[model samples]
Structures are given as C-alpha cells and as structure tokens.
Target: MFHMNRIFRHSHLTPYEADYAQWCAEQGALLREGRLSDLDRENLAEEIESLGRSDKREIESRLKVLLVHLLKLQFQAKQVKEGWRSTVVEQRRRIRKLIKESPSLRSYPMQVLAEEYEYARSDAAGETGLPARVFPENCPYDIDDILDLDFYPQAVGSAGGQSDLA
Candidate 1:
C-alpha cells in the first residue's frame, strides 16, 4: 500500500521537498522501462510539483511543464532503444551480406558455413540459398553471425594488408 497526505505550509518547500512524490513515480516508471536520466532528480521533482495547483493560471503553467517533461522522458526512452536496436540489427545484416559476398567463404558448403557462423540455417539459406538443416547435428540454425576477423580492418583490406603497418 502507498500513502499520500497534504498539509498547507507557510514556508515554501525549497523545491526539493515539494515535488518528491511525482519525481519518484516518474523515475520509478522510467527505470522499470530500463532507461536513465542525467538531470537532477530533486530539481525535476520541484519543477513538476509546480504544475499541481487548482488556480487556472497555476494549473496551466504547471501542466505545460509537466507535459513537456513527460514527453521528454518518453522520447528519450524511444530514441535510446531505437538507436541501440538499429545498431545491433544493422551489424547483423551487414555480416550476413558479407558472408554472401565473400568468395572464399562462398566456396564452402552452405551447411558448413552456417555452422561456422552460428547462424540459423534457415537464415543462411534465405541469404545464401542453402537449407536450414544442412549444417552439423541437424540442429535448427538461427542464421545469425558474430563479427569476426573477416570484419577486421586488415582482413577487409582497409589497411592494405601488412603494408599499412610497415
């Protein structure tokens, strides 16, 4: 169970004590969603509390601030998740594309390549036209590959072999 009580105070809450509850709630929700904020939580609470009055002017002003902050929190979560997800997804897509493109790797049987890459045979098949169960042990393949030496600068020829080091 939770508790909330209100008592009028002649002296103002110095900002920190004023909006603790709302800030705590917002932060709890954000953390539950696996997000973080760099701003001062105490200050944010104070600002949010200013939005709680019954007067039209006070309510509107505070409501605007609260809405903006809420939107910011939601947007931050979205952007962070999307940014991280896209990075992983794009890297995976790139690796699959490379396996399909590499001449040496292409020489190997689709099953053999799929096992070595740890990708699903089905995914490999989709990318390389091979069967999903062609690899060792007949275990279902997920067709995902981790970044390996082939993606390194030297292996990719970006460093022009050992000559760049010399």
Candidate 2:
C-alpha cells in the first residue's frame, strides 16, 4: 500500500536507516556546520549508550578469561603451564587498563566476579578434564588478589597457605 515516491519524499525518512556510511558523513557535516536540527539525534544517543554497554561487556569477558585461567592454575596444579600464566597476566593487564581509562568502571570487576566465576569454573573444568567440584563453589580470590600482578593462587592447603608453584 506504500508508494515509493511518497516514502522518499517524507522528511521523517533519514539516511541513518538507508545508508549508514552516508549517514555518518552527513552527521559529521551537520555537526561541523552547526546544523543540529538536521542531525540524527535519536540514533546518535542510542549509539552513545551502546558504547557504554560495550565497555561493560568487555569487562565481563576479560573477567571471565582471567577467572578461568586462575581457576585452572589453582585447581589443576599438576597441569600448570606458562601459557596459562601468560593469559592470566595479559587479561589482568587489559582489565586494569580498561578500569584506568574509565574510572567509573572501577567497581565493575567485583560486581561481576561471582557470576563470571561460575562460568570460569565450568570452563576450567572442561578445559582441564577435572570435575567442576574441584573448584570452589564461590570465588576464592578477592578482587585485590585477582588484580595483583604478583599474586598467584596457591594450592588450597599448602603449608603456610602459600602458592605451591608447580
């Protein structure tokens, strides 16, 4: 029932829905020219919100990776490898960089720890061929401990509670 000419003629139709590259160029031009009225305000706002969410998701993903490696290091002591330690260190560095860049995200690591820990536990078990029960049901590492570059998890019951690096 819609007519092509009418749809094309409608001022409500924006390049944002038709050609994204063109829309971005047009948006930039609009901003440069101070033509705020011609800008795609709603889509711009949504894009900004999406960016924040993307950073949070990145944090969650990095936390999951870090926790998974830590779990493997802690529970599968016999299988500890340099690669696992490297991954843990790399993920921690990336996570720290993210938090440093966005100070608002400073508390996000702790907030997401428990949920990401559950996922890490499952992943570690699958990767190491160990029972899920081998990992503590709750995360044993505090946020500080996990973030500490020098802090590696010790086997759960080592004398003096020190990490037994295999």
Candidate 3:
C-alpha cells in the first residue's frame, strides 16, 4: 500500500516527464472534464508547436527528394530510369497534398525548396557520379516548374538547347 501510494504520488508530480502517452491521455481527460487547472499547459503548448515544425520538416524532406530526382533526369538523361520518375511524381503528390491539407503552409513550399536545394544538388551529384560542378550552384528550376506534373527539364545540348545551368 505504501509503495503504491508513493508510485501514484510520483506520477502526479511530473506526469508529462514520467510518461508521454499517459500525459497526453491525462491532458485529454482534463480538457474533457473542464479541469483546466490540472492540465499541463506548458508541455501541451510545446507539443502543439512541435507539430507545426514537424510539418515543415516533412515538406522540406519531400522537396529535397523531388529535386534530386529531377536533377538526375536532367543531368543523366541517358540513365533515366522508371524508378526516378516514380519518386519525383510521388514526392510532388505528397507535397501538394500536404499544402492542400494545411493551407496555412501555402508559403512554406518555396522557402523549404530554396533552403534544401543545395543539399539536393549535392546529393544528386553524388548519386549520379557526376562532378558537383556539373550541377548549378543555385537551383535552376523554379518552385512552380519543380511541382508541375508536365515539367521535365530537357537534357543539356539537346537540339542545341543548353541547360540554364550550362
């Protein structure tokens, strides 16, 4: 009985620190019961803010994957594979869905694309066995072009059409 009492007391002191899932359940119950005084307001607010950050990170990661595959298609036209095309399509779909679901994030796509473009460029060069210099120092495709389903960059020097990067 004494050990059980001690355990219960310890859990009440810092429920959020002790067990996150239990903390969430307890917070929900508190909200439902109108026990505002018992809710972990600080931690709850932090978690909610973290959720927004998580969405931003997701957008950035998907953009990077899309850009990398696009670069591969542009620079290695001879080696273009179905898998690369599929990835580019899938990432664009996911990014579009994310923005549609969270309209407040409508402006985030361009910001994330610019921030992640360098990493994507480096990754594309590494994956394609091409010199980093082979790719442009800055992103060649605009955000709209990158997300366009019909957009595929032409290969450098195709029909005398040099890449903007070239």
Candidate 4:
C-alpha cells in the first residue's frame, strides 16, 4: 500500500513528463467533462502550434534534399543521373502533395526557396566532392522547374537549348 501511494504521489508531481500518453488521456477526459479549469491549457496550446510548425519544417527539409539532388544532376557527370533522378521525382511529388493538402502552405516553399538552396548548395558540394564554386551561387532552377516531372536540368556545357537550366 505504501509503495502504491508513493508511485501515485510521484506521478502527480510531473504527470505530463512521467507518461505523456496518460497525460493526453487525462487532458481529453477533462475536455470531454467540460472541466476547463483542470485542462492543461498552456501545454495544449504549445502542442497544437507545434503540429503546424512541424509540417513546415518537413517541407523545408525535403526542399533541401531536392535541391541537393538537382545540383548533382546539373553539375556532376551523367553516371549518377538514375539515382539522383529518382530522388528528385520523389521529393517533388511529396512537396506538391503537402502543399495541395495544406492549401495555406502553397506559397511557403517559394518563400523559403532562396534560403534553403544555400544550405542545399553546401550539401551538394559535400556530396559531389566538387568545389561549391562549380555550382551557381543562386538556385538555377526555380520551384516550377524543380517540381515539374519532365524537367531534368542540363549541364552548363550540354548540347541543349537551355544550357543554363531546364
């Protein structure tokens, strides 16, 4: 009986920290019971906001990965095309799907494009083992080009109408 009492007492001290699922259940019960005063309003608000922020972060992260692969396609030799092409297609699909679902986030990717590309530029350089100087200082491919299924950027010297980009 003493041990059970101690366990119950300890859990109450930091119920949210000790077991998050239990805390969530308790919070839900409070809400359902209309016990507004008992609800953990502060943490509840934080968690709700966190969900939105996480989706944006995921988009930004995928943008970076997509940029890196596109750079590899443009600057590196044709040998790696198959692997990089697959990644580019997948990222585009995912990004487009995310924006479609959220609707509110339609413009978010373009807003963060320039900033995220800088990170992607560094990543591409590291992955390709070529000087960063080889790649353009700014993103050569725009969001439309990046997301287009048929767009495959040609190298600067490639024999094409768009030697600069697709």
RMSD of each: 21.7, 5.9, 5.2, 5.1
**In model 2, what is the error at residue 149, expressed in angstroms?**
1.1
Per-residue CA lDDT of model 3 for 39-158, tens digit only, reads 689999999999989989999999999999989989898888879878988998998999998999988989777678999999998999999999999999999989887687878656
Score candidate 1 by TM-score against the native.
0.18
lDDT tens digits by residue: candidate 2, 100-150: 999999999999999999998999899989899988999999999898888
RMSD over all Cα atoms, model 1: 21.7
The CA lDDT at 82 in model 4 is: 57
How many backbone collisions does model 2 have?
A: 1
Model 1: ten consecutive residues of lowest lDDT: 148-157
lDDT of 2 at 78: 76
Runs in model 4 lying further than 4 Å from the true structure: 1-14, 32-34, 162-166
Candidate 4 lDDT over residue span 57-162, tens digit each: 9899999999998888778845475567788889989999998888899889899999999999999999888999998899998888877888878875688665
lDDT of 4 at 121: 96
Query: Model 3: which residue pairs collide?
Result: none
Question: After TM-score superposition, what is the CA distance of residue 70 in candidate 3 from its true location, in Å?
Answer: 0.4
- Model 2 ranges off by over 4 Å: 1-14, 156-158, 164-166
> Which whole-number lDDT from 0 to 100 does residue 26 have in model 4?
68
In terms of lDDT, model 4 sits at 0.79
Candidate 3, overall lDDT?
Answer: 0.82
Question: Mind sharing the TM-score for model 2?
Answer: 0.83
lDDT of all predictions: 0.35, 0.82, 0.82, 0.79
Candidate 2 C-alpha RMSD relative to the actual structure: 5.9
Residue 133 lDDT, candidate 1, scale 0-100: 44
